[model samples]
Target: MTVLHALAATLSRAGRLARAAASGPDWWRGAALYAAVLALNFVGVWVSIRLIAWNKAFFDALGALDGQTALRQVGVFFLLVSASAGSWLAADWLRKRLLILWRGQLTAQALDLWLGGWAYWQLRPGFGAVPVENPDQRVAEDCRKFVEGLLEFTLDLISGAVALVSFVALLWSLSTFALPACFAGQVTLGGLMQLASAFSQVTTALSWFIFFNRDPAGFVAVCERLDGLMAAARAPAPLPGAPQAILRTASPDGALHLQGLRLATPDGRWLPALPDCTIRPGARVWNSGASGEGKTTLLAAIGGIWLSGEGRIAVPEARFLTLPAGAPVFAEGLAAAACYPEDPATQGSAKLNAVLTRLGLGHRLDTADEAALSGLSMGERQRLGLARAALLRPDWLVMDEATSALDPAFEADLMTWLSAELP
Candidate 1:
């Protein structure tokens, strides 16, 4: 069963690679560069063979004590040497070009799929999708190594195949050189040597890469990780526990509906269940309870973002945004962080300054540089989050104690501000 699954996965991966190659930019793709590099490499091998023949002639001239012939052979030696060196240099250049093109093409596609449809968010540890550790390494370094090693192996294979086919004929033509007549003439020992040489090259190359190097393992690990990321992203939301747990994507505005709503823990157990209820549009509502109560869970359920357990939530398809108790600030500068989810320039600097001042971040009115936001305390960050929400004015804002980090008076002031601003 595992073998069969492995075969299926290999085929799927190959198909995906083929499609990516086809879809990539026509002029700048890796395959075309690789093909050109392969041709240049074959030329290099052919030049190398010529240089070997040049060696024989140059030595024969010296053995015969022919200064003229030896001098001529010296010039022939230099010519072949230059040609071989040029071929090697060109092939090396093209091989590197192929690496970058392939890495860029693959990494861009992987990032697109990984970030598609909010998969990055959903694939967190406690979220529905399976978490992928070291995703940054997987995307950046893994993509680079995968492309580099694949191109290296592929070029070597092509070179070995070309050498086997062409050099065997060259060997057959030179059968008079060293091999016994019975072997080279009757059994074709020279051709056999060529085949052995090609086979040995392949064996040595693959053995070194797989056994003595880390690239093969890295390639396999990256492949499996990227495959899992795609699989998790493509997975559908879990089915509702029963017909009672209906999911509404588009309901009328301000009409929050909940029927037998049950929120499940990450492990699939129903932890907090809410009875049927409706909070109509424009309703002034406050939900309070101890830590174990379903207050936060209820908000998640009502927002139609919670996926587990039994019940229906008919929340409107309005511009819904949630502000968690611990608000997140980015390192994208004060203005950018404050105006997140909307471009900072959309609202003018004056309005942003007013909101920041109201949220007690008035000192940051002139702070637009990208110094790390890590210096901001939790409460200060929450203040920025509130400022962001206030500036954007979302239609259905769900606050999960978004003001919890603030002092009591400031918390009350922020809540009142939310009520006046959001309503």
Candidate 2:
């Protein structure tokens, strides 16, 4: 029951996971390998059937004490055993390989759904209708479990069905049935038919219990989480009565405009409303307040990623960049992280190398850190975020306490660099 519970939960996500993977051509290529694996597994099952016959012959020779026959049977037994073993081993290897590929595809699908179209952003507090907890597990661990579980159950079912069919045929061929004369007189059905019907009723009831009432609590838990994430990913462009013009393309002249726009919490409660403020192009304006003053919320609303806000905001598109409080770093190496939100390849190696050097990431340039960029301190993450802004050369840059982590001197140096470097 424990195993069934675990399997049902994981397999619940398999259909959606496979659909996500099948969206691309690479996963389809994996399907061909899947067919090959099935063929190999069936061939192994056939070998087992042959081995069962060899078992009878070998035992008969031994029972007769026939030395010549026993020796020949020994040779035959070895051949059958070797064939079955080889077939099983080969099929096992193929199944494992298939598992790896299938799991990889499923994982990639989950990532794309979570990351693409700002889905990750909306799942944050005050942005989504559904609360998604431990999305990390859903995207990583659950996907692994789902792929492995589905393959295990699917293959076992296939092999068991094949073996059952073979055994039933053998039994039918070798068996003879008889009944008491009185019983035969009372029932028109033959003894074999009566036996078959009785066995069928028992097996059918057992199978029904196994199939329809199988525990699915584990799968249900995952399904609810994934469904929430899916809802977040499919979240509509704007909430009810959201002014379309306000969410339109940013002002062309690099001006930031706010007209009666009020920032709200996730549940549509007003946090702090902007009293119609405007920042002229190239003007230096500062927004400051005590803690919980909705500073970050304001920044998000202006950036257009926050749908919890109401009213109007006009900001730039590509020329606008936001340096949020926390640096968003990916696992792709240092160069990629520095040029994030923009392809690293577009910035030549020499240019990226120079930016890292100028931003005091020269040591990182050598390390070429290809991991998650997790080892970096708060200050280091801030530096990388700033470096990205400089590289992008955005006409409009919004910093929400982006420089708070760095020392005053370093912060001054960064502001000075940006002033000198950006137009």
Candidate 3:
């Protein structure tokens, strides 16, 4: 039962992604590309059928010892081969291009949701009530694989259907021919053909039933990954007044206010409750506590991320940015990473370089290669996180142990720079 449910869910998600790609804004172009591929596939099938006929003619000529006819049939063989190869290659090229195009659309949508709100954070294994595993794989690898599989399977199905119809018709026509008297004592050739066809179809059906009942490993893995991606895309959005224990409202004044605030884990275990208080605009308050003391949870509550809480938290209506303990660094260039969540092109390179320089990440700006970026130390990553905050210059900045990796002196220096630079 669970397996069936998972399969159903996988199909539902796959169908939605496929439909979205097909009906997206560039639907006409996608439709055209698909039609071209399908037409090419049909042409290839026709060439194959023609080659089958050519084989009969060539063999007949060879049996007759007709040199001229045999040579002519060989020439026809080359023509059919050329047509088949050309159509197959063309169709293959178009199919690949279509695969990439659809993958792009699917990846873009997945990314939009993954990065839109607290989804990236909340979908972590232990972060939310319902966690999605290997979200990165879902966005990067699974999207590509899913689209590739969909196309490959669809084309294979079409080819099989066309071949089945053509071959069945040919067989039916040939069944009219009488066999030798010794072979056909009573049963007609048509009856024999019908029986063979029926047996073949029943065997094929049974084989497929057994194949599905056993649950192929590769397909099950794909379905599981698709299910994860679907969950990631549906992760809760970071918005005020979400359906959670907390009731968030917009502050009329430019201040952060908490009233009757209480916190709890997703499992319903209560945490230290925050006393009713207000942090007015321009207040540089810091939350400090030992590890596992709910300081980070408090920050999450203030940021509208931790939903398992009851409170009337009022936040100012402004651009908000949160810097977690380990800020994310993208494979995109240093400049882009520094000004993340915002287009790097919109920000001047000089400003980006200066921010990184201020944060002591200037030396690392030369390389945007992912491998090089991966080697960044914890301190350097925190500095980059600060650089993002600096570049974005949000009206409200929430740091949850964001500078924990840096030495005291450097952290203090960065803090001073932030205070001087931001309001």
Candidate 4:
């Protein structure tokens, strides 16, 4: 089978490569490797033919009595050497060109597949996706190695097979064919040589198999390593589904509906947000439970961060905004950064200015400097965070102590802004 065919078959059989471990050498993959063996055999036979030719010439020169003629023959040999060297160089150059093109194509395809989706992040920590060790290395180094190895292996097998065939033919012709002796009876050099060569070839073949079968073993070992990494990329299964587990239904206008959302980690498990509760859209719901009540964890579960233990969080078909403790201010322009997740261009300056003014930061519209925002007191940061939320106008905004820094007056003002926009 071709290298492409074997790879396809292996991938198909592996299903979700992340879930199952790869086991044993797939014989189908061995076919292309065997082709490489054939290529190597061809190289061996071709080299052997050159050796035989050199031997013939050396012996003929030794038998010549005239040193002058031998000298002439040596000169001719130099020309022959140069011609052969040039041919070998050209052949090698062609081989490398072909190899590069083949490898480039495979590399591009593998990279595209790997980079697709949140595949990279999914394969990272705490996400339950299988942990691919040294993901960068796998995507960069191993991919290159796989392509090179597959190509070399396949071509070598092809060349080896051709060499084996060619050598057998040449050897048969040279050793076979009946020839009549000048003064004696006819001799069948062909039959004698054929028999001897057959024995020799069989012995050589057996020895080669014993020594070279290690190649396939090594190849499979590499494949297994790659499979191990692939498996590590799959997300761990959701702790066996809860009895009668059901997902909450979301609303049409993108409001978040939280109805008795109760969740607890499984045995021997640790997670935040173990609080059970219900929250309605635009309700200004306050989670007044004490610390460690999993208030933040509750928020996370609702926002779709941790999916391990949960009841149901119905998120309407609208943009959902979850602001953790501190607002993440980027180094970009304050206006642009405030309306993150939505482009400043989309919201426009007028809308941005309105939100900024409402949050009491109207004077810094064109400030462009980040120092102004960063130097703000604690209360100012909360106002900016609120302004950011207002600018985006997300369908659902889940705030975890976002207004903590603001005093009663400012906090009341922030609450008023949120309540006014609730409908």
Candidate 5:
């Protein structure tokens, strides 16, 4: 009864482990490969059992063998060699293929989540407990390691269970069903010896459980460390409030609203960057501060590039033009420069020159064009950014120190033009 109970428990646990391994998404992704590998692995195990049986038969036959029959063992030796080679090759090939596929799926999932809809940007500002380490390394290097480790773990667990089952069955067959008793220098037997064997097996199993439980504990520790590393790598944004805005054309009257704005750093546990400030529509918002007082950060928050902390930002959907501290220039001709952020093919030359000429950049349209936009001067790039805004005719134009590069004459002309253009 004791032996029976131990076998029943071991079989039950092994079945559960196998079911879990086979049911995961990782299995489905490379189901064919897993099936092949599992089949080969089990076949090898079966062959190994057969080889042991044959070895036993050989030993038993060796005592009664004649010279002619003795040579037949050589055939068994060759069979063992071939079976070993084929089984190993099959198992190894499938292991590598499944691992590669698993890594690929993990990497692809990470890439999609990272690039889709500003997820990377949000991570920088600290959103969830999800790790955002060297995103390049995490997505590229660590993903592969994670997948490979998981694959090895799964395979080892499955194979271990199979090994246990094989060994237990062998033990059952090898053991004699006879009770042993020594009393007064004599021995006596009861019913079958299975109950005594079962008790011994149960004791052995209990000993192994106490010793092996440490492995799972170590695995949990490693998982916790991974989570910690990811948390440490996160870069939380310094700005608060979700920027929800619409293109200018969508709203009859361009309006920008800020409500309950807050901000914090990745490491910060309490204080928010902004203490809940709201800016009404058409307000001449001035974000003045010393260098690095989060002026640029605030502008980025308003531009809908960063979403961290708390609060809400509401704006009529409209075309939004944001000019960073440095402007951006296009390498295309003057027409392309003016129609930047929009294709030049959509706008006529007359409209392009008109906006450029108004911004003191009319002379640039006739210059020799080049493929590299970096060839232009910084001031020239700044003017191009303004020209792009003019051509787009966005209802909301945000200039973040854009005029700092322009001369007084052009700056006044540009601001005057901007004021007039805004209804």
Candidate 6:
């Protein structure tokens, strides 16, 4: 089966399992504990943000030689640290409690299903379509491992999402144009105040000594230039005209329909108009044109990415996969990299090796580490892209010069295999 088919099957089974688990009597209690754990995690995150702010204040005080303020910040530091530690400890305890509670419930349910339906007799080897190799271990040990893994992965995902949002917000605040303006204003004001104090001192000295000095106009000029540069950087450029209304509708039948299509750049410059056309389902199209002829743009518009044009495009309601000229590889293992968008553990090693070998990439399978997978040559990466398409078996596949790096014979062989496999 294709990866997509297996994934669908897995999801169907998971849905049933979820419904079964939710129907249990103590499901609400388990959910409540889980919610409490998540709430405590949020509290811990808030405390961490507070601690970060405290670090800035403490360091500023130290830099200014203010021992009293520094000592007070240190005291606040301990309070925040205590709150953080307490929140995490409580969360960890609740998490463990929820794990055992869910584990017990799951194990009981598994036992009931295994014994009540006589699955132990029917699911034995050579009896059922998919035999249970070790039903005993599956019932007793797998239940515990499943619950532990579920809770651990779920918590890790939540923490990662929260951290991503926090970092993005911090970066946005730091990068705002207003931040630079604020710093520049403070610096300019300080320089002006110092200049005024020096002028006053020099004037008093001049009255006594009758000495002449050159005017200090250069400092003021430099400040004015700096202000001008900041203002220019903050100024907003004129935006382009509103994009044309390009109505995109989903096709009921598995075909691509383009009617009255005209492409344009974001700045409103028009490209060559495309003729009204309908591509039948399963058609392999090759768009050949000179460079700068908007071929890539046309593909982008068809993919619903670039819509600065006028026309109606009807796209099929099917799984669509796009492979660009430079196929990107993630820092994952070989099987995971090949069968992306699907769990790596779900893909068998033999299948991965077969696909890589078919595409002339089997040699790198053993040698390619997670870090090295991303640094593969262009041809190898393109082969990996083809491998994904073959394994995924999407309904509609789009490529924009995806095989440009491969040699003629090898590309032809890969395409032949894909056509036969995908057909």
TM-score of each: 0.77, 0.72, 0.75, 0.50, 0.51, 0.46
Global Cα lDDT for candidate 6: 0.69
Q: Tens digits of per-residue lDDT for model 3 on 185-297? A: 85433345444553454344344434533224665476567656666557653333323668989998889899998887655667777789999877888777667768888
Encode model 5's per-residue lDDT on 1-423: one tens digit a residue.
Answer: 997985565445434323433444676758888777878877776766666555544544555564455467658757887997898898998889877776676555545556654556766535544545566765666555554555666665676567557746754654443223332332222122333443444344345434543344443333333333333433333334433322212223455555566644444333335654544455667677787566666666667654444556565676778886567555566676667668877767787778778776777656677643546677877877887777787767788898788889878877778777665
Give me the displacement of residue 51 in model 2, in angstroms. Answer: 2.6
lDDT of each: 0.68, 0.68, 0.74, 0.56, 0.59, 0.69
- What ranges in model 1 sit over 4 Å off? 1-28, 60-80, 118-137, 176-222, 236-246, 252-256, 277-284, 302-305, 365-372, 418-423
Q: Tens-digit lDDT track for model 6 on 50-167?
A: 6545655776677678899999998998999899899999999999898888878866776676666444543445433343455566556655655665566567557645754664
Q: CA lDDT of 190 in candidate 4?
A: 31
Cα lDDT of model 2 by residue, 254-326, tens digit: 6777877777766555676568877886777889988886988788767666767668787754477888777
TM-score of 6: 0.46
Q: List runs of model 2 lying over 4 Å from the truth.
A: 1-14, 21-23, 59-70, 125-127, 176-220, 223-228, 236-246, 250-260, 275-284, 288-291, 325-337, 341-384, 405-413
Best first by TM-score, ranked: 1, 3, 2, 5, 4, 6
In candidate 4, what are the lDDT values of residues 256-299, reduced to their tens digit? Answer: 66554555542324443333444455556667677865677566
lDDT of 4 at 127: 46
Q: Candidate 4: worst 10 consecutive residues by lDDT? A: 16-25
| Model 4 RMSD, rounded to 1 decimal | 9.6
> Judged by lDDT, which candidate is best?
3
State candidate 1's TM-score.
0.77
- How would you encode candidate 1's per-residue C-alpha lDDT over 1-423 as one tens digit per residue? 998997678658645653553367653456577778888878877765665466556666666687998899788878877887887898898888777776677778778867765556555665553566767777787677666656666677677667656655555565554457555464343344444454444454445444644455566665676666556666634333322244655456558877776677645666655668777766767788788766886776665545566766777767877888877777677888888878999989899888888887888655556554647888988888898788888877778888788889878878887789876
Better of 2 and 5 by lDDT: 2
